[model samples]
Target chain A: MAKRTPLYEAHVAAGAKIVDFAGWDMPINYGSQIEEHHKVRKDCGMFDVSHMRAVDVTGKDAQPFLRKLFANDVGKLTIPGKALYSCMLKEDGGVIDDLIAYYFAPERYRVVVNAGTADKDLAWMRQQAASFDVTIADRPELAMIAIQGPNAREHFWTAFPAGRARTVLLQPFQAVEWDGWLVARTGYTGEDGFEITLPAAQAMAVWNKLKDAGVAPIGLGARDTLRLEAGMNLYGLDMDESQNPLESGLGWTIDLKDPKRDFIGRQALAALQPARQFVGLVLLDRGVLRSHQKVFAPQGEGETTSGSFSPTSNKSIALARLPVGVELGDTVEVEIRDKRLQAKVVKPTFARNGKAMI
Target chain B: MSIPAKLKYTATHEWAAKNAAGTITVGITDHAQEALGDIVFLELPEAGRQVKAGQECAVVESVKAASDIYAPIAGEIVEANTPAVDAPESVNKDAYGTWLFKIKPSNPSEYDGLLDAAAYEKVAAEH
Candidate 1:
């Protein structure tokens, strides 16, 4: 039997179609995934993302430990409640996981990792902390709820009236704690929203309250499409331990400006020359783009990492790893079954803030 | 869940409706559409194509995965639904109302071999 989240009962009550996702029995959709996808883009929708783990690091050496663990510079997070998106890499510069780290203080930080990589991430962090003076605490007792859309913040304000004053003041990539809840103005959907982490015991109650406040319950199916449309990358689908950030469209997250800071994977990354380019594609045909499809450009053949139909754009889009010679506005042929269809190369972000960026 | 008693069904979850003109209209069952989630793209065989029973003649791509639509009986494709090809979501909205393709079956009696409403209900329930 797959593990169940605290809101499993609530999902069943809502008549959701349940599926096993990363060892957890999660809701794929209540009904009509397309409608659910549009609900998140146009209005407010709530997703029970409790399966993702939150690891807390504390003690005197927390800052230094995190600095060595992640590719991005955590020292830039000078303000409390500020969040940074970074890639935790192995010694060879291969991406172990992409995560969001929220700095609370010099000795306190919380990092949220993907659900499937939680156990591996915790084990890696623990092994790396063997020589450090930090304690890595896995907080499975906490559950996360991502309320996203154009009106997501308004719905959050309506649902949690007490949190409005403080949450409203939070800028993008910032978080605030109030009444045992951590509300972060960060989301994967490329929309203005909040990802709230609270005690797992309160998950069901909060979910019900949000439902009563007219927040539609979304499922993982829409979540994937939403993140894809936002030009965000999925961990395993987009990149893995064999892939480095430089070739996986995550080069921006790597901080190599300071030579004195010796972070893990720094040496391998510094010695590497990126040969592949990660880009977005807009299908010129009336078919859907799927992952693992062959992409042929003038330079060479590449593969699509993630692909889906974009409801916001009313067209199919995908994130592909292509040859470095492939530039923007160039046309590439994607092998969909026996046919090679034309697609236009463009920026990864197809939509943002409830608007189409393409 | 909405199994029309008048139509015949295949174990693969396709429904076939015989019209007075002898052409059989075919589409996926409501249960099949529900399982497939939101329909995104559909690939139907062109008209004038010959299809055999149990042969995969069409493809329905959902947000989650792609599923094959098999031929219920051997027939010549007379007409393919253009609206369903243009807007695949119509199949999710009303699977029965949005027929995928119409065929002139070579063996019209093959429809009698398909499952009835009661048999199809059992098959759908097992899924």
Candidate 2:
């Protein structure tokens, strides 16, 4: 049987197309995926992202334990409520998952991981934290809602007037606790937004309140397109245990500068020279770019990590991992079906925060 | 839902209408277009391409995914829909009105194998 989130019934009531995603019954769309995509880009939209796992790590040893576990240095999060985006890597420098760690104190941190990789991430965290006196618990009792787009924050504040605390005034990548809720001014969409995590039993009320406030309820369909347009990496398609973070456009998140911090993947990462670099590709011609498509450069071969039609660009674009020698402005060909279509390599980010950044 | 009683449909969802010129004007069913969602690009067969029954002849790409448009009967393509290709979203707006292509079947009796509007509706409903 497929797992169901707290908002499964709500999605069904909204006439959403339900599909089994990562062992969970989730909404693909309410009616039209295109319309949903436009709504988020043009106005305020909300998503029931409750299926994503939120694991809290608490103990006196949490700081040192996370610094040793993650490829990125968690020591940088000195201020409470500040968040750090990092990739959890295997001992051999393979990417296990990309996640956001929110620091509440020296001994307390909360990390949100992808739903599909939740089980594996939890097990790995537990195994590593066993000797550090840190407690890792998956908060299934909590539900997460991501309200995104330019008007997302304003609409969320309007939904619960009393719920908006001084923490709601927090800057981006910051989390604040208020009224039994953890409202993080962070989101996956390349838009101004907030991801609110609250008790599951109170989720329906919050969703309804937001709906009454005229926030458009979006689904997985628009979420994928939005993230792609923003140039954010989707965990499974962009990188996996089979690939290293350095090759998947996540090298910036890895902190090799901290010589004192010996993370799990430190030695492997230091020993291996980066053979390939991830670059963004904007299809100059017709045809949608898709994952697993072979990218051909004059100098070397490459493969598309995440590719799709950008709703903002109205053209196909992708993130391709290519030979480290390739630079921006170089041309390449992507094999789409029987034809090899021409593409141009651009800088990493193509769009962000509901606007084109390229 | 817009299946005309006078038209016949293939299991693959292409609808065929017997044109006055002894050729059949074909388009995908409304159900098929809706399933595909917001058509972006369409590749129709050339006017002279020979097609076999159940053969993949055309390609329709939507924002979500791509699908193949199959030939309903053994026929020679007489006319291709150039207007529909230029404005593919018209298929989503009015699928029955925007014909894909015209085919001259070698045997008219092959039309007997096609499903009528009522039968096609039942097939679509099953999905």
Candidate 3:
């Protein structure tokens, strides 16, 4: 049997189209996915993201252990509740998982990982934490809900006002605690909002309360499209264990500043050269670029890692890995069916904060 | 779910209408279009293209994935749906109204063997 979130009944009552996602019974959409997408872009929407695993790391060696654990240095997080996005890599410089690490203190931190990769991520962390005094705890008892959009914060504040005391001034990538709950000003969508992690028993109540407060219940379908438009990388598609972070439009997450930090895969990442790079593609013609489709750049052959129609832009776009020489504003041909469609290469980002950048 | 009583259906979810001239108009059922939400692109066979029964004749792409549109019976294409190509979502909005392509069937007796509306609805509800 597939696992169910605390808000599963709520989703059913909302007339959601349920589907199996990563061993969990989740809602793909409540009704029209495009309408939900537009709702988030123009106003407010909420998503049940409880399937993602939140692991707490505590002990005197937490900071030092994490420095040695990930490719990107966590040392940059000086303030409490500051979150950093990083990729955990293997010794060969291949990505293990991309995650967000929030620093509460030198000895205390919280990391959120993908649901499908949670088991492997925890096992890997446990194996590495053996040498340190750090404790890795996965909090499955906690449920997370992400309310995202332009007016999301206002609606969420109306649902639970206690968070306002600690989070009223919280900036992006910051978090505050309220009644043992972690309300973080972070989201996967390219919009302003919060991701609240609270006790599982209270998950449904809070979800309904938020809905009563006028927040739309979005699902996995809109979530995928929103993230794709935001140029955010999906774990299974954009980067896998065999793919390098540098070639997956995630080089910014990699810290090459410390040559002596001696993190896992640091040496390999330093020595490894990026032959192909990831860029955004705008369909100049009338077609959608799909994953695994061959992209014939002027320099060399490439492939699209993630592609979809952007509801905000009203056009089909994609993130394709092309030869290093292929820069922005260049033209590339994507083979769709039997026809080669022309597409323009732009920087691999379109929307952020509910505003279109392109 | 809207399988028109006047139209005949196949086990693969395709609906066909027999014209007085013996040609058959074919499109996917409403249930099929609803299952594949928010159509984005469509690739149909060219006019006069010959295809066999149950053969893959066209492709339909939604926001999620791509699926093949199979021919219900053996026939040669006399006309194709050009409007659905540009506005593919019309298929999801009204499946029966937007006919995909017209096929000039080699044998008109094939229509008799097709499933009726009630039978097709039962098949769709089973899943």
The lDDT for every candidate, in the order shown, is 0.93, 0.87, 0.90
**Residue A41 lDDT in model 1?**
84
Per-residue lDDT, model 2, residue A151, is 85
**lDDT (tens digit, per residue) of candidate 2 on A282-308:** 998777788889998877889998887
> Distance (Å) between predicted and true CA of B39, model 2?
2.5
How many residue pairs clash in each candidate at the backbone level?
0, 1, 0
Worst 10 residues of 2 chain B by lDDT: B34-43
Model 1, span A1-358: residue lDDT tens? 9999999999999999999999999999998787898888888799999999999999999999999999998888999999999999999999999999999999999999999999999999999999999999999999999999999989887887887889888999999987788999999898889999999999999998888889999999999989998889999989999999998899999998888888999999989988898999999987889998999998999999999888889898999999999999999999997899999999999988878877
Residue pairs with backbone overlap in model 3: none
The best-first sequence of candidates by lDDT reads 1, 3, 2
Which candidate model has the greater DockQ, 2 or 3?
Answer: 3
Model 1 chain B poorest 10 in a row by lDDT: B82-91
TM-score of chain B of 1: 0.98
The true-versus-predicted C-alpha distance at residue A314 of model 3, in Å, is: 1.7
Error of 1 at A337 (Å): 1.8
For each candidate, give its TM-score against the true structure.
0.97, 0.96, 0.97
